[model samples]
Target: MRSMCCFSALLLLIMAPVVCQGGNILVFPMEGSHWVNMDVLLQALHSRGHSLTVVRSNKSWYIKEKSSYYNTITVSVEKAVDQKFIQKVIYEIMEYERGASRLVYLFHLIVGMFGTFLESHELLGGFVSALLDDAELTTYMKDSKFDLLLTDPCWGGGAIVAKYLNLPLVYNARWLIAGDAHLAIAPSPLSYIPVTGTRYTDRMTFVQRVNNMILHVITQIQLSWVIKDVYQKVCEKYLGPDCDYYQLMIDADIWLMRTDFVFDYPRPTMPNVIYMGGFQCKPAKPLPQHLEDFVQSSGDHGFIIMSLGTFVSELPADLANEIAATFAKLPQKVIWRYKGEKPDTLGNNTLLVDWMPQNDLLGHLKIKLFVAHGGTNGIQEAIYHGVPVVGIPLFFDQYDNILRLADRGGAKILSLSTMDKDDNFLKAIQEVLTEPSYRNNMQRLSRLHRDQQLTPMDNALFWMEFVMRHKGAAHLKAQGNRMPWYSYHSVDVALFLVGALILLLFTVFFLLRCLCAAVCKCKAKRD
Candidate 1:
């Protein structure tokens, strides 16, 4: 007993430092569904003994001023990308998509939403300006002695803040200001890698490939324009003329990419990029008694769960009624997260809730299928739990996200245009429910995702701590981000080699002509 006690004391002494080694982390997060994932990340960090401080706009819709896990630094701004703004944007986009022709929809998506997109960035820029310009906030941030800055580069303000503060930067990122986060740092060949909105897969047809290239060019244009118009001016004024906003974004020590090969199409990735897709997912806990009772009532047929994600609280009334009517025909019980008007067509089998424990429900054994808006979080959760999906993609990357699963035979996509025509939505759902391949494919992906030696969350935590242990991970970052476009692409080298080859060819021809002339003159003299 004495020996055991001595050994235990020694172990406690040895493990004390490791257990208590916590770093002060500053976070700059985006609003909407982005915050949902970011909140999960923050909770994980807090649980690991790290201190966190989050910066937010006073009008932020999701980020609370008070929290059990982290401290908040609220910056006052006139305008913000809040719930109202997002809902309005989604409503307009959905309405336009449903009413217009495909080509016209494409034009509307580009031209109609461009102003709103630009305005979102402008609002974010205003928030950033407000935060940095305030002397008190700047002083407080500096005095806080933060070890690192964690941010979602979706808004671009976080990268700028990291530069101004001279902190080691890490990204909890899927999208940067422009498009997919991978495109900014990785060697993405448009031949195979599809752009965000193009919906092309690794094997694209010729026309699709052409569209991919055009979309990629448009993304570049968007990136350049946003940086120049919104972020670059602020960077130049604050971080010096040499501080390029694009470079600052790509210079982060690590990118905790919110996607894995299981969810995302395979592509080239950087050394510093750590794929942590479905990190927010875990085994389901016991559902509330009422919910469990409802789930249990379905018996052998199981149940279907539907959610349209954070931005969409409710869909259009006619669409909702159509969906309800279809669900009324189903044998399985349905639990739908909706805040819209109670549809008159809603059936006895359907339970309408304004909110749900989505992740928990996905993990349940009684789950038959997921009806989703194809948000990254929902799709990734479905993948993690091996639940087959019925994806109704609406706006933005939803189509692309759903198509990835559709190509793999794990999900079925029912576009809004065809959803109501000839009971297409009902047919799509029934097809998925009847198909064994869908569930089997999703389960196979789940196995692949889960077969990792370390959990994705643990992997993310390891890399984050690795960054803190060493002040910054300069060794892992590529210098190509700083290189000029021509130099990085080797266009200058190619031009030089071509010029040299042309000169050599000309010289050889000239020498041959001279030799022929000499030989002809000698022959004439002999004659």
Candidate 2:
């Protein structure tokens, strides 16, 4: 009987499916470029014992659902943020054109700004919108029975679902998560923390520091207002009146930032916020034979890879022409990801495609350099492959990303405003290709980025599982959530100023008393 029992136990141990404490992970990526990170997260979760499901659109190849993985639920939300109203406002701002319709544009800007404010409030407007779409998402949640929710900060819908379901929420911040409170995790030095890795010029003039401080103050105020008004309203509508949206915002069970401590120094990190850098993407497969041959044919004067990213597909014709003209001058071949109408006069050396396997191309040994729009994902790919870049930042966080890359000696920044200048374009490309420092720096950064104990995806998976196993883990959250904003961050500064004033008043009083005494003594002596 004992021998038979042992044999049965051995068989069960060998055959039984790995049970992982009811681990179910629901991943939500931002509208676009989010797939870049989500793909890795899926793989990491699968590697562990967790069953995973991804919720995203089919916007880019990065987010395309793979059947080999657990399950992928496609959620379709109109990319309305990039609507005509928003585009027109952006056009007016970019062109600096004031016309009879300027007031209309200004109004739209105000509305858009207000909308953005609401969008930032994960608790209020953001959450309300998601609750309204509950029918579409609830099915997935119900079927999956997720133990934890891993969502991008931008995906207020996921956050809402997590709150509604009462699941542990882990905010996967792809970029810098800047907030007035210390608990918010930023991925880059653009955050207001005076930490070490920030590249803000040490010898900055007083004027520059003042300007920076003003900018920081303005950003903090705007963000705080948006969170309170927009996010709070949505939270109250869905999560009930008793729900403290402010606390929910701060009580994120875990903050998984896609940033490395090596690249970003002097990190002002909280205990719950973990650095999960390089989770943006995975090492891609080898290039196709034909593509490999084409790259090999270029020899030492390798090809240049150019991409404007998904959001900015419709490049101005003039900009396209300038790019074409610049490519015409290069001895090496050029592979351009152009989504618009192809030009009649194409450069012989240029290869235009609607899309190219960006990661595969970047990994090519024949690819000498990359010309990019300075998107975070693109930057990561470039760094991962140890290829230098010529960054022409278009908008949003691109400006900051390009600046950081340039500061790190891994890329050269070409202001898109001046992209019309052929001299500048030519010079930028030439410098990136010829400069040995750029390559060296990229290689160094690559080492630092990859030389991690756990990849970003691993860290994300670990936390997702951690949250699942531990339940809410709300105890790890900061106490700042309960305190008023003024009391939380600025009370010390306020106290210092108040103390200085009190001390100054006391000193003045003492000086006045001494002077009176001296005058009285003089009068007595004279008498």
Candidate 3:
């Protein structure tokens, strides 16, 4: 018995280290930005016993700092050539200057494609080229082995690295995946069945249905072009001829979307395309003492929190003056994140700062409304904190995001083009604050949006494990790749109708000819 006990103790000690060493996950987020969602995901994975390695461009400020959650890797890319030089070259080649600039813009598109092909979609081309050429990046890739390559969809390099290393790839889409049917899990109003959960009705009004159909068709065309022209060539170059771009993106072991089903109404979804919505969100943090005092000083009248996010701060001076004037007259105090030089005659009630801790400001109890440019991250934060918004969407997906929020009665959508109109700006602020319905609706959404029993971090971890346990389950997604465009749209019926019409016309022609010939024969006989 003593001998047996000794043997058992030895076995237990031997197996302990093996069980503790979990799989390695490498993460690459977009350069130069602090997307809270990505940060939460990395933290969640770390808690789950997985070792994480985060690779980022030096341009990214987030990576410059250190965190205990994961191992960090920074890749420095070359300074991009001037935008003017790129524009000139593109105009010379394409002979067009509309939309995005020709030269520099074309480089952005091509490099983006190349990055996507390489699976490092987060890193821009200039950055990717710089990293690929860097001795440090090459050395890191050669030495730091990992079990899985996880990346945000914005960075295509993750895909590239996954292909090169022949490792499993997991894509975390900051928004909806624009293309790739496998990753395209949002539901259509026209579809009768719900793809993710069956609790909600999938029906839509006729106009809504038509609009959705058109959007889907347009998305399909655009995605096809991106896959063929951008992703394919890059994949061929890095992954060799045997690799398939469509299959690589579509067949990702897991596609995690950072969107909530409650917000995206009447949309179809799939199991494989996991909706890890609000993964980056957290309960509101306590307000700073000075900010608290500022809010309390406002008394019964509330305040507005204005931020345009990080990327675009080029508000025209006239528009800024107009906003300042509008705030000057309002009863509420305003906290604006303005990067430009401070105006000399700033209103008494308005506080303009070069930077503001957005999440903390929005969480303040005195903040009655939010004024923003409707970026996804900003919108999500506002929604998470139950703050009603006045969204002035500038570009990209901001327009769609703000419109969707407005449609839900949780926010108001205004255009920057008309922001100079003091009446419009003031009226918008009044409507947002006075309207009980908007507040009620926003609170209702907040409940639904926040009711996710699992925080975004937990959801991400759960799905990550789900992928490992079940390798590429069909029940998780629609068979988008198996069907052609005709099949997807049920265009076979239209083809059948056309074929039947042709057959009927031929039959009629044949019958007429026979009757005419018979009549001629009778006439001849009579003669």
Predictions in order: lDDT = 0.92, 0.67, 0.65
> Model 2, range 35-59, lDDT digits (tens) per residue?
5566667666776667777765433
Q: Taking the tens digit of each residue's C-alpha lDDT, what string does model 1 give over 439-479?
A: 99999999998999999999999999999999999999888
Query: What value does the lDDT take at residue 524 in candidate 2?
Result: 100
Order of the predicted models by lDDT, top scorer first: 1, 2, 3
Best model number under lDDT: 1
TM-scores of the candidates are: 0.97, 0.79, 0.75
Worst 10 residues of 1 by lDDT: 106-115
> Predicted candidate 3: what Cα RMSD to the true structure?
7.4
Those runs of model 1 whose alpha carbons end farther than 4 Å from true positions after fitting are 1-11, 524-527
Residue 144 in candidate 2, Cα distance off native in Å: 5.5
Question: Which tens-of-lDDT digit does each residue in 188-249 have in candidate 3?
Answer: 44454222211122454556556555545655565566566556666776677887766666
Q: How are the candidates ranked when ordered by TM-score, highest leading?
A: 1, 2, 3
